[model samples]
Target: MRLGGRRKSTNIQDMRGSGSRNRGGFGRPTRRVRLPSGGRTMRSSGGGIGGIVLLVILFFVLRSCGIDPLQILAGGGAGSGFEQMLPQSQRQNPTPRATPRTDAQTEFVSRVLAETEDVWNGIFQANGRQYPEPVLVLFSSQVRSACGFASAASGPFYCPGDKKLYIDLNFFDELEQRFNAGGDFAQAYVIAHEVGHHIQNVIGVLPRFNQMRQRMSQAESNAMSIRVELQADCFAGIWGYYTEQKGLLSRGDLEEALNAATQIGDDTIQRRTQGYVVPESFNHGTSAQRREWFARGFESGKLEACDTFNNDV
Candidate 1:
């Protein structure tokens, strides 16, 4: 986490105060079409875990109203699943505001992103492929992404639809205070994990997963999601490996990242949220799995070592 003197990434969009004025409004203009060629929506299949849950609720609601679930999903209406499930009062299309002051936290995020860019670029080059850097969008409260509208409550996510990473800075506070996964390295791990998604997109892993998930059952898809998330966690560790090679990591930095991986495990979150565990609904992997994969990547620093798909993750 010794980030001093590290270069900051220029691929950043600051949209802190330029969010929506209404609960469901977009502060900025967004594309009404499907995601770009390389972009997919969210990570989970069937619109992601939240999306699936909402879809079920919505289906039941529509059915209760004597409406067809298929029609709503295919309604092409303003209140479609894509538009209705956002946090209330999320607005977009606000006037561009002045860039916020650069603080230590912001600088740290940028540096970490830059490091990922460097590490991934090298890795891709070694594989005879060029790396396309993804944009990182910093927002507050709520933001509209090519994937969908999301609030801080949604946590950090990568939008393949936009080839960008979306993060609400407040989530860092939540990670530290609520999740008790505080540390600069922990924060870096979060960013690197999303960047790992970008790597998956570049390598065509996400697209295939998205397609396969469409045909998968909820339990099956959630299992697939755990693999996807764990792979990203491993990728984050890969980045950590290179960072350590560069002598940028101090003692206990890796521990911070590992603790973060454990704290945010699906089991831990589920236990905290509902006071019970539901292994079937777990999208992200268990704490042990996450920690194990991360350690695997850091120890080996090999892409082949990070394959959570072909092997039991």
Candidate 2:
């Protein structure tokens, strides 16, 4: 977590405060919905599976017309259901306004991204392959991606379609306040996890999973998703391992990441939100599972050891 004097990544797009406004409606009548603090009141196309599908179709139609679909879904709350359908992203919102503190947070994210680039580049070269670095898009309120339109509530995510990571930095605040997963390393874990997805995309794992999920039942697909997410957690742990080896990790850095993995586990989130845990519906693994997989990667630092698909998660 001690990133003092570290390099910041240049492959970052600062789209903060430049979000486009929602104008025309999709198909149905647009309704007004209140966003979190500093968020704009935008129009929604309605909620439900049918409504989301319709909005997606509309999104394509608008894209063909050279319009940004993010404008359409910004106020619609349609991104929630489609999160798992695509690659994983973080979702949470805090005040949208920029501040000096936010600048520091942005700097921290850039440095962490640089660290991942350094670690992964070396790993790929050692394996006789070149690493193609991914760009990270920093946005507030809403942003349009090749995967689809997303709101800040949709969280940080990596889109394989675009090979870029999208994040609303405010989610870091929510990570600390709502999930109780604070600290710089915890935030680094969040970025590293998404970068882990980028690794999956690079290694063809994500495409294979996407193809296989298409032929799976909902339950079966959810199971695959758990493996995919756990693998990403393991990849993040791999990054952590190298950081520790480089003497960059502080005393409690690993604990911060483990606590974060615990807090965001599907079981823990479901238990807190619904007062119960549904193992069948769990897609991101349990608290114990996440921590274990991360620990496994951190301990071994072997890509083979991080394989959650063939081995028991």
Candidate 3:
């Protein structure tokens, strides 16, 4: 990705090297050096389904908590997608411990965020609606938000309650080393996938899903989640569509994002870890499904193409 001279997003809340104890019991970063979540990295993928356009947005909503999502893809096994809504109180507003010094990687993430803002803001404005930008929280070992406590091991996740995406930059290192899915675009995909969840929240998809999921059985929720995550994947692709048009993408950028998506698919992770696949446990969809939805959004650049609920996925 050619992010040179791009504007960095001021919406970021830098909290690296900051740690605080929480009732969740996950305060210390050293004690819980997450496996590698860059690549649960609860990313999403796929096409089809109908109804709420925003319904396509929640597919990338919550990831499994503190489960090095990438390590699972690298062969840890028994994993879920990147939409984790930790059962923390949304009222908590813990103060920042400190703001660690920024670096090149931080600047990169901020620039990518700026790109998404430019894209989504224009999209929403075109439709006569204002796009509410979500705050991307840059935390280290642990941080607190309306969504509760998290560790870098939790990977990158969007909290609908708080409308903020949380990430530990170290997850990128894991993406490159553990999973071998490296590149700036791959990182952008992770951020965009989480932002997709925020899109769901803004458009009312996430609120509905969060309410409905409570009444659903575990299996039913998992099934519904596949659609949700895939839609988010499509949303990320939609963002990619605009990003590409802006001439920021290099030749291998799309593949880098797709490779990251494939590495985190439920089947790919399961096949590598357990030496078998359990279709029932699948929540994020297959590798092909993810790649397809992302491509669907990228190739078509239309929200209608991401309806994973009404059409065949």
Q: Pick the candidate with the highest lDDT.
A: 2
In angstroms, the error of model 3 at 143 is 1.9
The lDDT of model 1 is 0.64
Candidate number achieving the greatest TM-score relative to the actual structure: 2
Q: Report the C-alpha displacement of residue 58, candidate 2, in angstroms.
A: 38
| Cα lDDT computed for each candidate against the true fold | 0.64, 0.68, 0.65
Q: What is the TM-score of each candidate against the true structure?
A: 0.74, 0.77, 0.76
- TM-score: which is higher, 2 or 3? 2
Error of 3 at 183 (Å): 0.9
Q: Write the per-residue lDDT of candidate 2 for residues 1-313, one digit (tens) a residue.
A: 7889987776677777754322111111222231221321122112312322343344334324432111111121111111232223333345875577767887888889978887777676444456788777788887888777877777777888877787888888877887899999999988898888887777665654554444556676666667777878988888888888777899899999999989888878877666788898776778899899889878877676675755677
Q: How do the residues 90-201 of candidate 3 rate in per-residue lDDT, one tens digit apiece? A: 1122333322423677778888997887777756644546677777777876767666666556567777666777777777776676556798898899898878777767
Which segments of candidate 1 are over 4 A away from where they belong? 19-102
After superposition, the stretches of candidate 3 with alpha carbons farther than 4 Å from their true spots are 19-102
Runs with alpha carbons beyond 4 Å of true place in candidate 2: 19-92
RMSD of 3: 11.5
Q: Which ten residues in a row have the lowest lDDT in candidate 1?
A: 71-80
